[model samples]
Target: MKYDWILFDADETLFHFDALKGMQLMFERKGVNFTEQDFHQYQQVNKPLWVDYQNGNITAEELKHIRFIGWAEKLGTTTAELNTAFLEAMADICTLLPGAKELMDALNGKAKLGIITNGFTELQAIRLERTGMTHYFDQVVISEEVGVAKPDAGIFLHAMERMGNPSKERVLMVGDNPHSDILGGLNFGIETCWLNVHQHERPEGINAHYEVQSLHELRSILLA
Candidate 1:
């Protein structure tokens, strides 16, 4: 293996995070018909909160609370209740991305695998368990628990410490987001691979050591 450890970002990188479908399932469970317009409205609040959370302007708890404020009001419930419900729905619908399992299987014995996610702890555990991917990882780090979101070096440092402080050059951080995953890993002095599954433009000044559109490509590179 080229690297001793392969760190991954959860959500879009390994798991298919279909927020719209998750929200729809959540509302359905609550006896509400969630429409596309409703999801659009929800994103208007949710997206910026995530940005703020990643930027350290807001906390994970605050982001969770604020994003569901409108929905909570409509549902006559507390933000905590709605947030929990949404996470539950998301967990129920969670599945690994195509080729994700194969990639993990191929690398299981060859490299140490771990997950460092900005995703909430509640959904993270259940999703891993449900998808049967829990045992494949050596470590699972959540920003909510660590008190630092990605794009900040602190979280990467925390992950490294937990990883037994391996040589940074022998670690590869694989994730979908350039700003958070790639930049964060690069800034932390580790090699990075940007998993641009949707073909998004790479942001300026945040180059990755490798870029691939699919986990299959990553597997080929790693097992080459």
Candidate 2:
């Protein structure tokens, strides 16, 4: 293997992250019809909050409760209740991306696998457990618990500590987000692979050591 440790981003890289569907399912359980408009409205608040969270302008707890505040008021519930329900709904629908399992199965026993995600802790555990993907990872680092999100050296440093401080050259970070995943790893002095499945344009001032449109392509590249 080319690398001793392979780190992956959870949402949209290895796992399918369909927030719209998850939100609909969450509201349905509460006997509320969550429409397209409702989801858009939710995103108006949620998206900016994420940017703020990643930029270190807001804490995870603030982002969690603030995004669901309006919905909670309408549903006669607390933001905590709504947030937990949404996570549970997301877990119920958790699924690996195409060829994700094949990649993981192939990599197992060949190299160490780890997940470093900005995704919440509750959703991470349940999703991995529900999808039967728990055992594939040697490390699961959540930004919520680590007190720092990606693009911050602290979180990467934390992951490196848990990884037994492997040589940076022998570790690879694979993720869908160019800013948080690729750039972050690059800044931390490690090789990175951008998983651009949607064929998105490469962002400015950022470059990955490798780029692949699918996990299958990644598997081929890594095992070559």
* Residue-level lDDT tens digits of model 2 in 1-224: 98999999999998998999999999999899999999999999999999899888999999999999998898889999999999999999888999999999999999999999999999998888888899999999999999999989899999999999999999999999999999999999999999999999999989999999999999999999
lDDT of 2: 0.95
lDDT of 1 by residue, 53-115 (tens): 999999998998999888788878999998899899999988888899999999989999999
Q: Clashing pairs in model 1?
A: none
Cα deviation at 135, candidate 1, in Å, is: 0.8
State the C-alpha lDDT per candidate. 0.93, 0.95
Give TM per candidate.
0.98, 0.99
Off-target runs (Cα >4 Å) in candidate 2 are none
lDDT of 2 at 63: 100
